[model samples]
Target chain A: MNMTFFQKFFLFFSLAIVCAGCGTDETMESQSSLDINPLSAKPSLFDQSPSNMAKESLMEYEEITGIKAVNSDKEMIIAVQIKHMKRFFMAKHRKAWQKEMEKQFPGWKVELSTDRKIYLELDKLEEKINKDTLSKDELKKEMKHIIKLSKEQT
Target chain B: MIFFWAFVVGGIICVIGQLMFDVFKLSPAHTLTILVVFGAILDGLGLYEPLIDFAGAGATVPITSFGNALVHGALQEADKHGIIGVVTGMFEVTSAGISAAIIFGVIGSLLFKPKG
Candidate 1:
């Protein structure tokens, strides 16, 4: 029952692939120090806000580095930057967060995404809102645009 | 770090191919065919997408990913249009790669002659 070198090597490689499939990815450490504070702890954008609650809840997860959220009367949109490695399981994380958020705020539509483009758009929206540069109608239109972008397949 | 992982994963894949050729006395064609089929199987099992997510271009750059793409396109279209979709969608994602291979193969043949 002597195995050739090729057979031995093949067996080892198969074991390795199986072990790799079994292993779960660990969440990576924060890369940058930007906005290390929780969004709820940040300077008040609005009091008793559902958007703030959404951001705060998102920040509790270590993989979420930065979060931007804005809500209309019926819809709450959230964008988060996940740690690079954890992005491998991003679909899973997003689904879990979506369920939790929907549960927390019943009757409110919770839209969560980890797309880089969405994050950048939300960041711009946050800046405009902070500066009070956007009118109510303008904010509503922008949110609608972002939601449309999220729904895009490509 | 991302680059590092990409190199490591891509290199490992190449190494495995090399081993199959050198140790098992497999021809290059046989080795490549086996790898591509292996990739398609992985994709069928819903495993290759996670690998691509984890390794980025490291996973996508290999020949294995070509098979994964072919199966993925077929499966996606099959869900929408049934049996006909499998044939129609087989090349949706892989048409670019196949076209490039043909064009490059012509260029390569024009540039060099095989002695054997």
Candidate 2:
């Protein structure tokens, strides 16, 4: 159909408004997941060593879900995979939380791999915390405990 | 149908420009420049605020939006520093985008061996 310029402008303008409006509900629904404060909440340090602190943080994360953290010094990587329903949302929160952890630890560098892997340096660990490497299960358990500690802090 | 609507909206904007040129006997270059300046001025006056409120991406994802950004930046700078506004203005507004473009362009040029 032949439409006048004004008609066409209004039609497209209205359509844009409708499309934006439709997404508003979904955006509102997603707002809770986007809450920055929860992720911003400070994580208490139970382990002094950078490796142990990273391990402890990962263990806490695992406790919340059944995920496992794998640390690799050679590659400078630590990562966890979880099948949580809110995986994407939780991952975003975890990233923010990791940033807070980095700030808390200071002097130690932390890097998160693109594939949701977290890596930490062993030398940066506090002298008091044990430097011994954790097995997969031990890491998982420790991560759970860390999550519990984090929740209690909240 | 969507493409039709896109064409229609784009055509309307062009048609308005054409009408302004024909009625006022404005040269094509002058008309184009005037349209850009007018858009910038309206954006500066905050008249584009309602348009942005109504059509978020529609108002923003256009060349006119750049004009709006420039005007907005100029105004913001004017607020801080009275007369030397224009010089400091564009940097405050478009710095991030300009920096990214420059950095990426340099990196892309260096890395990519483009075919003639």
Candidate 3:
């Protein structure tokens, strides 16, 4: 297209701003598997009697695309994938699901997040659990690490 | 993924604007007004939110976001305080962008000479 030098400069400047705002840690090449089975067969990490209530409650939320959860003795941590558009209201959804999960699984401190990074990490942990690769102690350590990461503020 | 989507969507929007200016011979002012109105209409139809979700700041940084923000702000405030909120809330989310544009336009006019 024929354009003045100023026009070209303006177009590039705007595109640069758009790209800068879109930067994230995620790669376009990788697909997240965490959403495939949000509640994988209760791995050894969850020694308690299994409950479908958590899965059923999670499924009720129309915006959720995927889920991964693991629990230690007193704490249950969950990472969820939300439909991109609905993410604008993440705080509301996070609060709603947190409340629902708490009600479903009483006597446990529940932690819920929609962060993609957390979902990826949990997916890896779940993979290890399925393969019988992670020890109970290592599993606890990993859970603690993931939980800390979730609490981190950017 | 967000980066890719944002670039693609923002690029397409910019392309459409460029086409309007070059092919239709529309003034910059007219093109911008039309885009903003289009955004507002989309917001009214509940379609802009999904676009924002898909494109992130790509959708937000464009001029169309001005329209979306105007309507969104008005609706939110109207829900809380009724009709008067429409006037007050219209500029709530868009104030920074609008104020910056005016201030910069003044400074630019003072600093630069027109080409034609």
For each candidate in turn, the TM-score is: 0.70, 0.34, 0.55
* Share of reference contacts found in each model: 0.32, 0.00, 0.24
lDDT by residue for model 3 (A49-151), tens:
3223465568667677777777667777788887655666776788888898888788888888887899899888877766667677888899899999998
Please identify model 3 stretches exceeding 4 Å from their true place.
A1-29, A35-79, A82-154, B103-116
Candidate ranking under DockQ, highest first, comes to 1, 3, 2
For candidate 1, write residues A9-73 as lDDT tens digits.
98997886555544423223335433422333223233227788777777788787788888767
lDDT of 2: 0.49
Candidate No. with top TM-score: 1
Given the true complex, what DockQ would model 2 score? 0.05
TM-score head-to-head 2 vs 3, winner: 3
Judge the docking of candidate 2 as incorrect, acceptable, medium or high. Answer: incorrect
Interface CA RMSD of each prediction in angstroms: 7.4, 15.0, 6.8
**Model 2, residue A124: what's the lDDT?**
21
TM-score of chain B of each: 0.88, 0.60, 0.86
Answer with 1 or 2, whichever has the higher lDDT: 1
Taking all chains together, the TM-score of candidate 3 against the true structure is: 0.55
